[model samples]
Target: MSVFGGMSKGERNRIKIRVRTAMATQTQVEGRYLGGLATPGDGSPLIDAYRRH
Candidate 1:
């Protein structure tokens, strides 16, 4: 049973686009954090990522 079975192709494409956009934004933010190039406000995720061992 697929959740998307009732959705139109365009709806599916829009969902995919939104998810891709979110993932790209996340990658950019995380890249900044991991590279130690992030500004002061973006501290929590950077700390968590560094502390994850």
Candidate 2:
């Protein structure tokens, strides 16, 4: 059995929600540091770096 084999459905959903929230917060910060989010056609170096991942 895996380490998380005993976790309930509710517990798993909570974990997923927490992870999604954290990722969204991180993306917002990255966008701010990259000179605000821009369209793909902007062709900015910062946006390029952000889109690399």
Candidate 3:
């Protein structure tokens, strides 16, 4: 079964949007600063992305 099988269409769509936005932001940051992609030595991507301000 699909992972989203139990979710409503709207819920799944919202998740897609969030994932896309996160992925785009991650790619942009990685390219501009981290040299195109996340490296193992760079540490956690999620933690770097959602840092406290």
State the lDDT of candidate 3 residue by residue for 1-53, as single tens digits. Answer: 56567567769899999987887898788753534555567584444656677
lDDT of 2 by residue, 1-53 (tens): 55466567668899999987877888787753324455566674434554656
User: Residue 36's C-alpha lDDT in candidate 2?
Assistant: 49
TM-score of 2: 0.47
Stretches off by above 4 angstroms in model 1 are 1-7, 32-53
- Estimate candidate 3's alpha-carbon lDDT, on a 0 to 1 scale: 0.70
Candidate 3 regions off by >4 Å?
A: 1-7, 32-53
The Cα local distance difference test for each model comes to: 0.67, 0.67, 0.70
After TM-score superposition, what is the CA distance of residue 49 in candidate 2 from its true location, in Å? 16
After superposition on all C-alphas, the RMSD of every candidate to the true structure, in Å, is 9.1, 7.6, 10.0
